[model samples]
Target: MDPLTLGSIVAIVTVGVLFSGISVAAGLLVVSGGFLIVFEGFSALSLMPEIFFGKLNNFALLSIPMFIIMGAAIASTRAGADLYEALERWLTRVPGGLVVSNLGACALFSAMSGSSPATCAAIGKMGIPEMRKRGYPDAVAAGSIAAGGTLGILIPPSVTMIVYGIATETSIGRLFLAGVVPGLMLVGLFMLWSLYSTWKSGDANVLRATTYSWRERFEILPRVIPFIAIILGVLYAMYGGIATPSETAAVGALLCLVIAMVIYKLWSPTKIWEVLRDSTKESVMILFIIGAAGVFSYMLSSLFITQSIAEWIGSLDVNRWVLMAMVNLFLLVAGFFLPPVAVILMAAPILLPIIITAGFDPIWFAVVLTINMEIGLISPPVGLNLYVINGIAPDIKLKTILVGSLPYVACMVVAIILLCLFPGLALWLPDMVMGPEL
Candidate 1:
């Protein structure tokens, strides 16, 4: 078959399989399987072990499982509740205070938890019900958690950053630092939007909840101090040249577990075992997808498809900003259908070189790409965050979550635009902290 026909077939089958409800790993595995056979005949079956291990045999990727365990440890504890209640004490006087507090909790939890869904699950269980009970609108309550949860992937220790760094061969530390400013900017934007929506609609009534005294505020601090330390310790370890990302992840996980078991008294043997098992299962699933994408990328390389597309993009005479916009647009749409990791894996090989050639800093592009990924987390039709919140509060209609998320989604778009305009937001922190990437 001609290249166009063959390419079309691969595209159709891959997307069809994914939309059919199979996991992303399964979808990529099928695609890679087909291309491997199509290109190399039956003898190619011998390469499975090499492909799988080769893709996963990276030092940096080791952080993924460690971070997963750390997040799971926190999730399996009272950290989520503590974080929310602590933030609520301070934020409860603001308009739509619960929503704002939920966003604050999600942000702090994002610092602890690198995965978006985990952030959502941990925060949603507490935030949604409390806000709903206090007379917050279903759409706003659910939407806030779903949108706020996206911060997990934008903050440091982000699993998405690890995958993106590995895929693009960027520095994971730099990627982590690059996310800090933009992540905070997005947080502010979300909070501002929350305040505006609540004030405009008079739902800011959450301020009516009993305001905490200074004593009460200080009392809640103990429950939150450990998590604060976890966030600061990991950031310092990575940014202050104390450890590699993998080492930092390992230390973070171990410390979090110690606190959970000894200090918080939240983790039992069964809970520890469950956390380990769940982390291992998730890590394996992600690794399989990574391996399959490696194979699929190789096939694209062999077919000259990626090179041809890159050359075609480079040939365009338009200004580079237009092309960057198009790339962001593509990512925004694709992220709705594909998980952030899958989108990063599939696009990195194709997009990174072009982005570099266009004179955009890879670090800035990574943050921008991540923001697009964040937007997808709360989007309609297939937003995983929406589904997660729905699972926690089954009475809240999915449509409510989806609608409520639209305002926060708009805030995220503003964030993406602001990042585009001021690449400094993404780059300055890395430059200041690490003295710029070579």
Candidate 2:
């Protein structure tokens, strides 16, 4: 079979298998091995060692576990619940008061967790019930938390951002910093949409919103201030030249432990062990996926499929803006079917070259891509966050969750466009904070 035809076949088979409910790692292994059968065959079996072990040898990857530990530690404590309460205190007067608080809690927890599903599970456990109690339409309450939780990956300390950085060889620190503005911008977009939808649907009028006095608002600060400290300290330390990304992760992990143990008073061995075990489990799964995708990416490179794909894109000679738009659109659609991290692994190798060749800022594009993945988490059928919210929100239909989150998807799309139009929105903070990229 011709190379193009052969590549197409393998790609389709892998995607089809994914939709058929196979693990991504397993699907990629089968696809990569299948690609070799058509070309390199048994001779390339030797590449297995390099594929699995070599991909994970870097010091940078250590941050995955540290960050995971940090997230798990915070989740194990009352941080998520405290964050929601604190936000609720402050945002009660907003149009979609409870909904806005839900988003706010997700955003704050996103700083600690850097994971969408974790954020969803943690915040939605509290946010959804509170919103429902406040007379929020079940769909809006469910959707607000479901969609808001995606902020975990778009905000700093994000595991997926680290993956993208490693995949693209961009600086993880810069990428983390780049996401700051875009992440906040997305929070605003989501809150604005929540306001609009709540007002439009007239749900805002009936919902209960407690107007908090300044003294009452001050009472909740202690519960949430420690979290803000951890986030700022870790990011600023990394970006202000006090720590490397790995070191920042370590500091964040340590702070998270302190918060969980001393602050939250969960000094028991069982709780500590559980948090570590959970962290280890998540770390192993993500790292294994990374290693697996590495092998698959290597196979694509060895076959020169990535080169061929890049050349083909270049040959189209489309305007760069047009290509960027097409890429974002493709990512948006791809989010419907593929999880964001998997899409990044496959597309980064194949498309990053084309994007870099066009002289677009990769870090900027990284934020853009992360936001696309954010939308995917809430999107349908396979949206991990949707299931997460559903699990937490009993009696809430998946259909309602999906329908309610559709407006937030528009927020993400708008974020992508604004980032594209003003790459500075993503780049400026990283540039100012970290200076010129090395």
Candidate 3:
């Protein structure tokens, strides 16, 4: 069979298997193995183990587990609640401040955790119920939290970015730096839509009767500020030439544990064990996906599917913007079914060369791709964040959650456009601090 025809079959079969409810790692391995045996012969199967092991051998991947530990530690504590409360106290006077604060909390927690579901669970647990109690619509209450949670992958210390960096052999530090401005831009976009939504619905007036004394507002800082400081410290360590991404993650993980212990008194052996266990489980899952993705990539290359596709794309007479639009559409669909990590692992390698050849900055495209994954977290069929919000408020219909998240989806698309129009939104910080990539 021709490579193009075989590639289409593989793509369709892969999607079918994923939607069939098998795990992503299993799906990728099964599809890759099956295709290789059927097409490349049994001898090609021998390299599977070697290929998988080689993918996981990278030193940069060390950051993933450490960052997961940091997220798990903070998620296990009251940090989410404290962060939300602190923001609420300060923003209470602002219209739609309650929901706005949830978006802020999601962005901040995302910076700390770098996991969307964790961000949603952490903040949605408190934010959703509070918004509903304050008379916000179920859609707005559930949707805002769901959409905001996606910031996890776009913010610094992001696990998705790490996977992308490792897969494409890009600098993880530069990828992290590139994410900062785009992350902030998405946060601002979410916030602006939040403010407008609340005003239009008159939900802004909902908080009019709620007020906090300055002391009350300031009181929550001790609990929240430490985490924010840790986030800042991690960013500084990465951008300041003080440490590699892996080293910064390790130190940041330790600080997260220490502070969670000191402030939240989360020092019990069971609690500590839980943190480690969760971290291990998440880390192993992500690593397995990376390994499977490696075999998948190898299979495609051996079959000439990857090269054929890249050559076809490069041969296009369309403008770079058109190529970007095509890439973005593909990513958005891929994200709807696969987790961000899996998507990055499988797609980044195939797309990176094409992106660079087209004269776009890889760092900038990384930010754009991360934002596309953000939309998928709240989208349907495989919308992990939406389900997390559902878990937080089971009473809210999934439809309502989906409805509420729609605006934020639009916000993300807008952010992507803004980035495309001004690539500097993602490139400026990284270039300024790290000196532009040669």
Candidate 4:
């Protein structure tokens, strides 16, 4: 068979296996192992152990767990609630501010945790019920949290960015910087939609009457500001060349644990244990996928599938913008079935060369690719954020969550278009901090 034909078959079979509801890591290992044995015989399988283990060897891998620990520690405590409440107190006077507060909280918490589900669950628990209690529509409340959770991957200290950096040999710190402006841009778009939803629902009068005294607003700042500072400090350390990604993550994790214990009284052994246990579980899951992806990558290379496909795409006579559109479509479809980290691990290396060859900045494309992945989080079939929102508000109906998140998905698409047109939205901060990519 031609490499292209065999590659198409492999893609179909792999997607089929994943869509069968099997574990992603297991599905990848099974598909890659079967293919290698079929084409290259059992002798070729010997490389599997080294390839899998080798994925974990990078110094950057340490940041994954440490960042997870930072997220897990805050998620396991009342920090999410406090963060939500803080935003709510300040935004009470503005029409539709409650839902807007949820988005704000999600963006901030995403920077802290860098986990989409964690951001959804943590903020949704407090924000959704409160928004509903204050007469926000179920779709509006649930959708806000679900959509906002996607910011987890687009914001700084993002695990998805970390994975993308490692996969494409891009700098993790610069990737983190690249995400900042685009992340804020998405938040701004979400907030606008949220306010529009409020006005459209005729709830502006009710929200207008709601007010918090200066005292109430100021009180919560101390609790929330420290966490925000931690996030900023981590960003500064990495961007200023003060620390490597792993070192920054380690310090940020420790600070988060300390703050959680001090402010939320999360000092009990059980609480601490839960934090550690959850972080370990999530980190190991990501690491396993990376290992499996390494083997999967090797299989494609051995069979000449990667080169053949890249060559086919390169030989196309399409404009660069058309090529980008096609690539975005492919990433979007892949994202529906695979989580962001898995998609990045499996696809970024293959796409990076194509993107650079087409005269696009890899750093800028990282933000665009991430925004595409964000849509998948709220989309159907395997939209994890949708499920998380449903879990938090079971009575809201998954369909409502999906409906509410659609506008936010549109916002993401718009962000991608803007990135394509401007490019600077994702590249400016990174360039300012680290100088332009060579």
* True-structure RMSD, every candidate: 1.6, 1.7, 1.2, 1.1
TM-score: the better of candidates 2 and 3: 3
Better model by lDDT, 1 or 2? 1
- Over 4 Å off in model 4, which ranges? 204-208
User: What lDDT score belongs to each candidate, Candidate 1 first?
Assistant: 0.87, 0.85, 0.91, 0.91
For residues 113-172, could you state the per-residue lDDT of candidate 1 as single tens digits?
887898899899898989988888898899999999999998988999999889888899
- Deviation from native of the Cα of residue 162 in model 4, angstroms: 0.5
Q: How close is candidate 1 to the true structure, as a TM-score?
A: 0.96
Worst 10 residues of 3 by lDDT: 201-210
lDDT of 4 by residue, 1-438 (tens): 899999999999998999798999999999999999999999988999999999889999999999999999888877789999998888877788888888999999998889899999999999888888787778888998999999999898899999998888889988988898999999999999887877877854436646689998899888888999999998888877799899999999999999999988997999899999988999999999999999999999999999998899999999999999999999999889889989998998789889988999999999999999999999988999999999989999999999989999999999999999999888888888888766
- Write candidate 3's Cα lDDT for 1-438 as tens digits: 888888899889998998899999999999999999998799999999999999999999898999999999999999999999999999988888898899999999999999899999999989888887888889988999999999999898899888988998888888988998888888888899988877887743365648799899888899999999999998898878899889999999999999999999997999999999999999999999999999999999999999988898999999998999999999999989888888898888889889999999888899999989999999988899988888878888999999999999999999999998998988888889989777
Residue ranges of candidate 1 with Cα displaced over 4 Å: 1-5
Output the TM-score of candidate 4: 0.98
